[model samples]
Target: MIPEESRFESDPEELVELPPTLPDGWEIATPDAGDRFTVARLTHLLRAHESAGRGWAGAGVDDVLLEVSEASLRTRENVVVRDPEGEIQAWGSVHDRAGGRMLFVHVVARDLDERLGRACSDVLVEWAVGQARAVGAARGLETQQIDTGAFADDERQHRWLAAQGFTMVRTWWQMSRPVAPEESELVPDPAEWDGRDVTFRLVRRTGDGMPEEQDLREVHEVLESAFTDHFNSHEETFEEFLHRLRLEPGHRWHHWWLAELTDGPEPQPVGALIGEVSPSSNGPDSSYVSYIGVLESARGRGVAKGLLHTIIADAAARGRDSVGLEVDADSPTGASELYLGLGWETRYVTQSWHRDVPVVEAD
Candidate 1:
């Protein structure tokens, strides 16, 4: 991943390190290259937190690295806290996500004392609150939205966010579907298949090995249009959309797919699916559908199913263990029902917590 320091552009409010918000005898500052222990512990904190909250841990080593990498620093700020004894106690990262939404990853040491844990959570959240205002002010937004998520079963996390004025806004089912090797032939070659006048194929690429600009734009437009009426929909520029997706850990160009109605006047793009290569430590890697959208106008025309079928077939052909995707449980289009019919099962549940804070404008 390449780093671009120009992205955040915090100017005067560039997140001054260690603002003395943490308590005495606790070291709080942004992570640096010299602190390998701090980085390793942060990854442990995430895995341990997920394991305890849900039934399993899915964030792999690479996934954790991307969270704290230099490239990530372009749009994210991270802080790590260590005790006077030099033991890392907590770590947090705040991402200046699209529009006015800021994503906070609040991870505290699972084995710390209950009192210390609360203190650490408070420190992390306070820092995030400040960062949110800085980003909102930079973007000239009146209301900054703090978006954080936690496993549905984690009562502790719920309490922490609730106490911080965040309300549970949505529930998501993280679903997975196993792909048998024989399922590779499930679809007759995505490139050549035109099912019901809707064609399913990978996003076109040029000789430069980069996705075609027109195709990329179409995919972006399809998703933006698809989710326009959904919950908490926000307008994200094409550049912002492309930049964020490229920062994903397992991001790849080949994983992107688009569906278009071939019989239409000039073949209109109606559906899109952006996938990620999920590397597993023990087995074949999986294919994760990071973003999948079918236009509301084309919903009943089997566009969504065609895209799903193409991904399943592609995963099987690639020898992946499974295909994973997240679906909003309260989707207006009954999306969860579609996945349920396609051999997917819910492995875990997550909830989105949001708090809206006014932009902390410069005095």
Candidate 2:
């Protein structure tokens, strides 16, 4: 329950307070739109430095730019650490998700002396948690959980997070599938399960390319119902859900699809898939499944499979190099198996760490 008017102040001068204990010649600065390229490059460097044999597929500048642009909405604060020479060396951000109930804190840095690395991480995380508390107070929330993640094999990050009071809570598999030439030859037909009266179709869109209001609502409803039982599920308003996804770099209306059963009195929405084009680290560009879900009543009816196949087919038709998604490794639905069976393979694993922080009114 953040106070309605307690939004994060983004005044750069007020945001760049460096810790007194930071190594001499190191400073902190709030990033702006102009820092996109530099931040992207620094991020790539940090990923490569920390990635343990798991190749880091770094985000593109546009991806970073979109994140920065969306910060006003979701981010409590973000900062970059630089050396005396002004070379960006590290970055951190705290994201307020689900309206300040959950905060995601991320910290990354280039390989540095053990002491300096630890100090820098400590300062950023401390500032991030402080901001998270302010966000919760503004929302009128009494408490919130601070969440963060690290590559499973990155011991340095894992150790740092542990020292910051986080505990490993979940693991995720980042998976990707290369688009096959033959995939384009596959018929673009709705999937049907044996003896199941189920069907799928591209969501109807207006001439302006926006999905019809009814279809959009159905998409949200289907996903909400489908993921109700999922890990860390939380109810977000339809407006929040839609706007959050649209804030990403490649969100487009045509990338949405729905699965419905026509065997009933009328078409009933049972599943939905939303996708976006993304800049790939391995190839030209890729399609990413941002959200895919099937209603509890529609499980095992090929509805989820149908939506996935349709997405792959669409990606192939557009000559995208690959399709990528992240799945909860502990998903009760065993979704990883389905993706693996469909040619997707795990590229890397990341672990989610969480810490419950007490919320108090902002001073």
lDDT (CA) for every model shown? 0.83, 0.73
Cα RMSD of all models vs. native, in order, equals: 2.9, 3.4
Q: Tell me the tens digit of each residue's lDDT in model 2 across 1-363.
A: 322332554543353456666768987777765655676665575456545425554655555565455444454456777778887666766656665456554655556777878877876676666666666676677776777778888788888889989899999999999987567645455232222576666668689877788888899998888888998776767776776677778887788888888788987888888899986665677899999999888788877777787878778888887899999999989899999999999988888888776777457
Off by over 4 Å in 2: 1-6, 9-20, 35-53, 70-76, 100-105, 185-196, 281-284, 361-363
Among the numbered candidates, top TM-score falls to: 1
Clash pairs, candidate 2, are 1-139, 1-140, 2-138, 2-139, 2-140, 3-138, 3-139
**Candidate 1 residue pairs in clash (backbone atoms < 3 Å):** none
Clashes of 1: 0
Q: Count the backbone clashes (under 3 Å) in each candidate.
A: 0, 7
lDDT of 1 by residue, 3-77 (tens): 345234333224434334455777776676346765677778888999989978878656666767776677787
